[model samples]
Target: MRVLVVEDETSLAEVVRRGLTREGFVVDVMHDGQDGLWAATESAYDVIVLDIMLPGLDGYQVIARLREAGVWTPVLMLTAVDGEHDQAEAFNLGADDYLTKPFSFVVLVARLRALIRRGAPERPVVLTNGSLSLDPVRRRVLRHGSEIALTPKEFALLTFLMMHAGEVVTKATILDAVWDPAYDGDVNIVEVYVGYLRRKIDTPFAEASIETVRGVGYRLLEAGPAGPAGPAGPAEPAEPAEPA
Candidate 1:
């Protein structure tokens, strides 16, 4: 998962970046609150590590603005102040979790993982659509209890789709959600990754679950021997909507 750390303290930020990178997460750091806020808003970050005190904008205002704008990306607020009132305020402003200074690196990682899981729909880190299950945190996938190996990007794509299972998602939406905004969109990388996913996630299974909407996009449907069936009636005809 990608994590954006908004901190003005140079040494502290470096420590966090190094520690988190070593933990296998893609990390980005910003010294100013406005830049942090923009990156957090524009980029595909799983969790945002925001410090309370900042330049240009304070963490309180940043968090408030993000929540007010309906950005539900999970946030883990960090502050040197350990006051209960401050914690309450941060949570009220939509911070998913909070940590004070002098914290252990391990505890922070644990908290981050816990908060991401809480904010995300996946429980037990296992996403299920019929018998197919992918454990994102563990980077493991199983179909009918059989293990399947998937590359990091393929796993990220599958997890993103499965997380929004049963909902039709557009290519642009998928791109922005699963990839960084800096990614080149002119190429057919999304299609290539989808093909990779199909080869691994769908071919081994008896029935296909990922449905391509010719003009709209793709939807991860339930795998059924009788074909796709859901409460919304027959799956809507596939169509990839114009990129947003």
Candidate 2:
């Protein structure tokens, strides 16, 4: 299989190149993020190994741009930083797998092989409800052509709701999906975030795309809301009072 390794460390890149060549895989190595992005975009490869910190566009930007430009090659990201948020951001930005620095070569080979086997299946790539659009790979959210900034948690919550658009998702389900499964915090936190979403995505535009189902949870309308401030639009059911 063909693999592209984009690591800024020349020694590490050469070592990986040699090791993978010995493992009976064709490997092409690039030493900077810009060169790496160009190679991956300009060539067809089965998979790519990308590093997070690099001169000229970083690994995150490279992956996001690749996905944005319709290059779906599976990417395994390398990062020395071992924070959960970093890993989360990597996946959120279209990384297929992640390996921290000082990783096991054996594990790396195994992961690469696994990604090759999985191949790239073309998913929707963007989630949308009416005029609201969310690009998971780019970590961007847009409403009526205007970008709406969102915190990671809020973005995640909105993604979940859009995924289940038109369905009434319970607070338990929202908590489990958006927050950690073992989250022990108050479930009402979902309500607070939902309110936050409405303020940004709904209220400002005089839209009611997110509907509160009394005694249940919430639902994101599949049709989404009307254009921003265009008209009173159709009347939506009154939202139940948010928890105190």
Candidate 3:
């Protein structure tokens, strides 16, 4: 496995490099936050060992900036201070693992291996599209950071559309994916619920995001200059959600 180590302390960085090399890893060390961030972005490493304290930008900023740019490489944070708030901040800023100073190299190796095993960027948090975001686990939806209320059926329908965002999903497709086989309602019911969804998600925004394909179906178009929202969801963060 290849690893990127960002540590300002030269001795500590070398020790980490030697230890990780002993553990079957190809290691590269960067002592500045700017250099580390550049290396993290330019190099393809299986995992990153980042120190929270560095020049130019801190570890938290490095992680956040990388994530904002869609570089989802796994980050294992290495720091000297130990505090509950620090740990929470690391996670909030997208650190996968945290370790205090004076740590065991063995435990470090073990955590690095575990982090690498989990593989790609699989965050526990739900996502947002356009001005809309939903957490199915919590049955909640948010628009532009403000929570938007949705009824059970409305939530189901919106979820279906957002899942197929940018696509011209027909009423029949909505019925099959959202409603139960036992449902005996008119397929026109899809239009009713689509209206319900618009009341909260789209109408609140300046430009209407959802569009109708005369006599065909409906699609959620992004309000940007780059064509419609496309099947990708929203502007850029149209996160690829799994099959519901």
Candidate 4:
């Protein structure tokens, strides 16, 4: 899963980043409210942590604008002010949860997990495609009742693919969601990780779940045996005329 932390306090932001990274979440940080708002709008994140006092925009305006623009990614408002009206304002502006400063990091993690679970569409606890299962909270993947070990990056990539199972996802989409916004590396890095995943998740099982789409991208097969089931591949040519 991915998280966006929009806090101006450098020390606090760094602390949060280290803690969440240890917990196996791909995290992005923004110092100003405008940057945070823009990042939240442009990218797909599982959850966001926004601090109230900011340089460009306040947390209230940020959350309000997100709601106005229909960006429903869960937002957890952070502020030093603990006034009842302030909390009320955040909720009214569509903040999913609120955390006051001097808060417990342990409690914050728990709250973020709760928000993710509540925001998930159907199966919030685990994401499954066929017999393959992934527990986002536990950061574990299981296939055919066997546990599959994956590096953090590999796990994040697979989780994103599994989240959108059966959909043909483009390389750009994968880069945006799986990697940080500041990543200046080649996009082919996606292919590298995909290859790593295929070796572990598909090669052993003899399952072509993650399939290359030729000129397009890749898809994770859903609910059935994997096959050449996506858009038709290059068509065969007609036979030459035999007339004299």
Candidate 5:
């Protein structure tokens, strides 16, 4: 295993380096946060042992920047502050594991092992097309970075379209996916919600993200310049269905 230790305490850092090396691990030591962050990003290490207090960027900043840059290497924070808030902040900023100062070498090694075994959890990605963004897990929608309120059904319908952006989705297909299988209500509900989505997600912004294909269905335009809203004269008509 390869490890990078970012503690500034010379004696403590040396002890950890020697100990990990004796355990058959390749170790790289950095005495400050700037160098630590640079090395962590520039090198591929199995795990990182980070100290919260250090010169230049702190542990929180280093990890935050790393994550912002989409680097997912596992990180274990080593810090003297054991306060609950500090720990919470570390986690909120994306530290994989946190160990307070005065920690035992054996315990540290074990924690590192556990983190490696668990691996990095896949980060959820917010779906985006143009100014619109949807976080399915958080159930949040943003347009141009501003939150847009959506009813549950509206959210479901919009999500379906966004998921299949750029494709001609039939009204029947949408009804089957977004509404209950047993739904025997008006099929025009799909049109109504599409209108609602356009009003909120497109109209005010002068975007025609949802395009109607008269006698067919609709499509959520892929991100970029959009043409006027209305029927995209039949190229491939959606499989015929009872009029919505």
Candidate 6:
């Protein structure tokens, strides 16, 4: 497989190149962000190993530009800084995988192979269900062309639901995804947040985009519910029915 390694550290870059070459991969190395971005955009690569700290544009900008240019090559971001926010930013910018500094060469190879196996598929910058749209990078939600304010928890719940649009996600699953998996609080919190989302994203627009699945869970409709535009009236009961 052909791979591009974009790292400012010349010594490390050569080491990675030699190791990968030994692993039967055809490797190309770029020492700075500008050169890396140009190589990535101008050539077809099975995958890319990019460093976050670069002299010219930086890793984040490189990945963002690569994606904007419609290059869907899977990218495995390498960075010395390890933080959740940094990881989230990389993912938002279309990075396929991430590895922090001091990582094992074995892990790197395995992750690269896994990414290559997955291949590159275009990922939408904005997620939408009907008139409702969610921009993960900007942390914005809009309904019917107007922006809607949402609390952090409410936003997380909405994001989870929208990501699984048209699927019934159970309370347990939602809790694990949106809330702390170690959370011991009442599971009904999911119902409350779902209600909150409906009020902001659906009720105001006279839409029923989120559907209760009775004993199952909830499904976000792919298209807005058909009806005349008007007040949505009362919010749905926040209590979910017991599974039958």
Q: For model 2, how many clashes?
A: 0
For model 4, residues 120-185, the per-residue Cα lDDT tens digits are 333245777766787765668887878999886778788778767888999988876666545779
* Regions more than 4 Å wrong, model 6: 125-244
TM-score of each: 0.54, 0.54, 0.54, 0.53, 0.54, 0.52
Residue-wise lDDT of candidate 3 within 1-244, one digit each (tens)?
9999999999999999999999899999999887887788677898999999998778987786565434567898988899999999999877889999989999999999998998756443565565567775466787667788777667767765665667898888777556543468888777767766665676565445566676777787643433223332233223232223
Candidate 5 lDDT by residue in tens digits, 187-237 = 877877777776677657666678787789988878653233333332332
RMSD of 3: 16.3
Say which prediction, candidate 4 or candidate 5, comes out ahead on TM-score.
5
Question: What range of 10 consecutive residues in model 2 has the weakest lDDT sum?
Answer: 224-233
Candidate with the greatest lDDT versus the true structure = 2
Sort the predicted structures by lDDT, highest score first.
2, 6, 4, 5, 1, 3
> Worst ten-residue run, lDDT, model 5?
234-243
Error of 2 at 132 (Å): 16
41-69 per-residue lDDT for model 6 (tens digits): 66889999999999977999888766644
What local lDDT does model 4 show for residue 67?
Answer: 55
Clashing pairs in 5: none
Q: Which 10 residues in a row give candidate 1 its minimum summed lDDT?
A: 228-237
Estimate candidate 1's alpha-carbon lDDT, on a 0 to 1 scale: 0.76
Better of 3 and 6 by TM-score: 3
After superposition on all C-alphas, the RMSD of every candidate to the true structure, in Å, is 9.3, 12.6, 16.3, 12.0, 17.4, 13.9
